[model samples]
Target: ENEVVASMSANVFKVQVAVGDKVIAGQSLIVLEAMKMEIPIESPRDAEVAEILTQKGATVSTGDVLVRLK
Candidate 1:
């Protein structure tokens, strides 16, 4: 299983992918907000989204797993 994790502490601004969605490398999966900036979290490789571990408006910390991929 592969997982997408948060790189910094922030609030989840948007979830761009849904479960079962096929994604390509560099595809934006989630957008996080911190210090008034929008940071996009992208897929590191091509895969199908297996699960979304975080939701929009949720708060996450650095290294928190946001999505699981297969």
Candidate 2:
């Protein structure tokens, strides 16, 4: 199992994957907006998205789990 966590405080700009979606390593799973920049949160390995813990327009902090993968 793998977990994707936010790397910094930001607003969720978009969620690119849904639960049960298959993803590849380095695939963009979410987009975060902070400091006027768009930051892409990517998958670290090939896996199936098991859960999404956040949504677009939601605020998140560093280390917050955004998605769970298996």
Candidate 3:
């Protein structure tokens, strides 16, 4: 299992993957807006998305778990 985490404090701008979705390494899973910049949180490895812990427009802090994969 793998957990994709937020790298910085930001608002979730978009969620690009859903539960059970297949994802590859480097695929964008979520978009976050912080300090007027958009950051794409990507998959670290190929896997099926198991859960999404955040929602669009939600505020998240650094190291927050965003997605879980299996």
> Estimated TM-score per prediction?
0.97, 0.97, 0.97
Taking all chains together, the TM-score of candidate 3 against the true structure is 0.97
Model 3 regions lying over 4 Å from their true place: none
What is the C-alpha lDDT profile of model 3 across 1-70, one tens digit per residue? 4999999999999999999999999999999999899999999999999999999999999999999999
Instruction: List per-prediction Cα lDDT, in the order shown.
Output: 0.97, 0.97, 0.97
All candidates: CA RMSD in angstroms? 0.9, 0.8, 0.8
Worst 10 contiguous positions by lDDT, candidate 1: 1-10
Q: Write the per-residue lDDT of candidate 1 for residues 1-70, one digit (tens) a residue.
A: 4999999999999999999999999999999999999999999999999999999999999999999999
lDDT of 1 at 6: 98
**Where is the poorest 10-residue window by lDDT in model 2?**
1-10
Candidate 2 local accuracy as lDDT? 0.97
Clashing pairs in 2: none
**Candidate 2 lDDT, 1-70, residue by residue in tens:** 3999999999999999999999999999999999999999999999999999999999999999999999
Question: Candidate 3 — number of clashing residue pairs?
Answer: 0
Clashing pairs in 1: none
